[model samples]
Target: MLTSANLLLWAVLQLALLILLQEAFAWWIIAIYALLLLYSATAVLQKRSAASLKLANIVAALLTLALLLNMRQAGVLHFMLQILLLSAILRLFAMRHRHEARQLVWVQYFLIASCFILHQDMLLALVIMLLFGANCYSHYKLFAPAGARLNFTLTGRAVLIILPLWLGMFLLFPRLPPFWQIPNAKIASTGLSDSLDPGSIEQLVQDDRLAFRAEFSGTLPERQQLYWRSYLYEHFDGRTWQVHPQRRQQAVAPPTTAADVATASYRIIAEANQQRNLFALGMPYSSSQGVKIGSGGLIVADKVVSQRFSYSIESALAPLPLQSEREREMNLQLAAGNPKTSEFAAALRQQHNDTEQFIAALAAFFNQQDFYYSLTPPPLGRDSIDQFLFQTRSGFCGHYASATAVLLRHAGIPARVVGGYLGGDWHPQQGYLAVRQREAHAWVEYYSQGHWQHFDPTAAVAPERILQSLDMSLSDDERDMLIPFWQRSSVLQLLSLQLMHLDYYWSVWVLGFDDRSQQDLWRTLRQHIRLIAYSAVAIVLLLLAGMGLWLLHRRRLSKPLPAKQLLLKALKPALKNKAPAQSVSACLNELAKRYPNHAAMLQQLVQYYELAVYAGQPQAEHSLKRLLQQHKSSLAALNRAIKNT
Candidate 1:
């Protein structure tokens, strides 16, 4: 009942199915899974044979068909995983023959690989190796005689012998990129969007979800200087700000900046936000494949970032060139229907002729007024800009940036809203910065003095929000949930970060090591390979030398064997020349009759010979040798009689 075939079949089926259990499944499907597991346990523990299994087998096939037809809601990979899971479980009930058991081993190999594909946790990967050893032992037991003890030494030797060949192939194989993109399942994430609306960004900032992590080429920048812009909002209705169609349709050209300013290099690992807008410091230009700088100096990913994505960029961190009249006209667009805010802005402009002076005047007004930077701001009527500027005077970065851009546009200053993160929590040990969603912000960029200049009216109202983390600006109530565990306990903080470091290397070397990473790795590996390249070439010579020793050992073991003389001496009287042959026991009986005093000794020698030679028990050979010594005198007499005859 405890057959190795059944053990392996159930083991692979159970482990592989556990991996897929993390996927979204119907409640009824989970019930069926538990039922199948129960059925397998019954067969193993109770030694019960499969009954009415043909009907169950038919039901399994029908279920597979049903899954194929109803998997429109699931991804292709998810569907395939489910189908394999069902079939793996089904095989547990049917491993009754050698052919079927052999097929099950092949299925187990795929199951192990599938587990690695779906997950890369350190503990789980370690578990797979342990399971692999068990599978190898199962293979030995499946073919060995019944009740044979498990032989781990055989499996261990086989793995060691194949290790060198496996390493050589892996290091020398050519890497090729995938032809099609694997569809990523959707992820719930927090980041900037293509458009900005009243309260959209303010509500987003309340979430403490991590956005991205950045590492710089040199010393980290000051908190005030970290402006990671991702989106530029131009067209604004009374309540919402959106991207002008013309903005998205702009010619795919690099953003031009003055060559005089120094540029800094930094790389970022961004979490999947289901948005194509890329975040970077200053105006970024990328040499990474499939990424390009679009209009308004915004970096754009080739597709929705559905996983942790990485890219490198160099930023000038200076004034960007702005010359297109079309861009000027687009940025100046506003809902003329909101006339009250426009009239108020015109009066503020009357006091200053210079654009810089007018911008300063507006900043002075927000500072002088009783404006409160509140997370929970009151909703406005149709004339949102008018209400927010004159009446409410209290909202998040969105309310401040929107009103500032509206006022600047009404004053004949072309301005647009820039959306991105502001600052991040610095990790000195890792030498990186982790930007969170709470750092989401909006500021105004105006085309002034032959270049677009950055301006933030909200910065004038609350400068601490720009100079430090959002927690510094938020009340204790607003920031309680955002507090990191590390801040509360020293031990937890140290342990969490240590685990993060392990995950970083695992992702970089394993999950993220695609064809492109391989090409880059090859360049570095080529130098080391140059040093050890001779080792592989020496394999043939070493094999020859080892084989010579093996042959010498073989000669010593089988030497001085004259087969005819040995056979005659060993088998002569005991295995007679009779027409009808007798077994060793029967031959011993005939010999015992001739020498009655030695009958017990003769029969004992016969039994020993049967165990050592016929039954293939090497452990019994010692007893056989002693019995042969004791029977030498009797056998000599019988041999002389046979010789005379």
Candidate 2:
């Protein structure tokens, strides 16, 4: 009996932590918790005295309080969470009464809510269903009469009855925006940023967590043609790249490339990343009301993407023809540093006559050089491009892109770095592209011949990374990454993909169900809205009536037997010479005399029956079962004696 309670509580805590602790708790804290949990389990199994547990609980409480108060590494919220978890552990070990056990039930609800708050994924939703079932059973066992088994059959029937009501309420509830601004809970920022520091792009590659998923409407573009332009960066301050300051002011309809628009309009389901940076294939033509398209044909949100967001996007496959005086000047602007980088650009300009030829020659230069594409590049000095070009000659996409933009500007050409995701693993089986943070890439877009064309210098060095997924584009050394690294299991990769496909649709239909979708649904059912509403109201009324009837039926079935009925059944066997319903003491004497060998058991049963029937002991369920068991044995002895006579 205690085993079920212990396992259920522990399982709830473990599952909650599995979801919450992904971006929260430290390793040492988890290790310490594991040890304490082991000890608590041992104490319960050993059946330690209550007094011993009280002393241990006091020490544990003091230690936990001291740890939280003195710990500077964790925030107040995290500390509160830690304290709550510790108290739960302590309470689990020291459960002594029905009151304390009831307290644990409320705590389980809190843990479930905490997990939901942290993870809004479809997988969590499915797991929550199982958790609900377990909780129902645990609750039944906790408060049920001692020695009585939980009736799962009744529980299942109750769930089946309630499920329809739950579904009705969910469908009928108005989809309203949040009443209060939800806090950006403890997850770190992920993927691309407007500003690019020395190792900013490098940090993104280390985390291969899903950034967003794309599902297209038509045929997909070629690998090289799939240039996902997030937003344009127009300013460079010697080392770092910043977004064009007047970008918001320059919000205008971007020029179309040639006459051909993108046939492959896609919908992107982006994960929340504590930032407003949203992504698409190229230029986003269609989006939700909350989103805005920048002048450079990139998506921008009014608020931080605090949850999973879905937006439709239409992008042209060809190069975007950006033609404007402001864009030309902004993209061409260069910082007053890196004299050697300027000199090299001047030499390249002197070699080529035409602007297009100079760009092509420059693109060729990266391939002709000894530059190496690497994840682990050496640190740079003051002039980053000068060092990368002359000495180190090794860096990722950000390095090559940044250096080329600076070099292009020095040569009197308009160029800027375009930051966004590149290639995604096209899961043919699922028909959705899984784009991870490792696909976070930066490349140069130089304006020439009245058009802005995309050029990835990283492609000249590491073409495979542009052509294939991150995992397939890695060296043996990068493939074996384990410490603070991302990995995909080759054995279960296909299985994982199929599971994610299911989860994605589930999230879209369930978690991503919003006001717009509700309105669309409402439009379809407008003619029958009154009929549906009436039917729903009628169903709810019927359900309430049914539940009231069930309660009354259960009461009738399990109601305790009255004193007269109970006494008559107990005394019937020994009443051969007496009245049909003999008094308790008279029935007891006859039974004890007939079964003298079983006198002790008969006396115990008689005392319990008197306490329950005459004294009216409310908590007599356990005593009743014991009395009935002993009474059956005494009746057996009487029968055996009668047979012998």
Provide the clash count, candidate 2: 0
TM-score of each: 0.70, 0.70
User: Once superposed on the true structure, which residue ranges of model 1 sit more than 4 Å away at CA?
Assistant: 2-77, 86-172, 179-190, 206-209, 336-340, 378-382, 484-487, 511-517, 524-645
What is residue 562's positional error in candidate 2, in angstroms? 41
TM for candidate 2 is 0.70
Q: Per-model C-alpha lDDT, please?
A: 0.73, 0.73
Per-residue lDDT of model 1, residues 255-304, tens digit only:
65567866778877777677888887776655476567777788888987
Per residue, candidate 2 scores C-alpha lDDT tens digits across 1-645 of 455455546645544554454454566666666666666666656666333566657858786876666456555545656666666656665666667767766776666566665567777766775665566567777778888886779868987999999886677678777787544444466678779866888788877688898888787778876767776788899899988788757758654544556545887888888677688665455566777765777777777786787877776665666646888888888787789999999999999867888878877889898988777889998898899999999888899999999989999999999998887878776778888887788998888776787788877777787887555556778656522322255546656666788888877788767787777877878978899999999999999999999999999987756643554565454544466577665666666786688677667767766777778885553576656665786666665665565
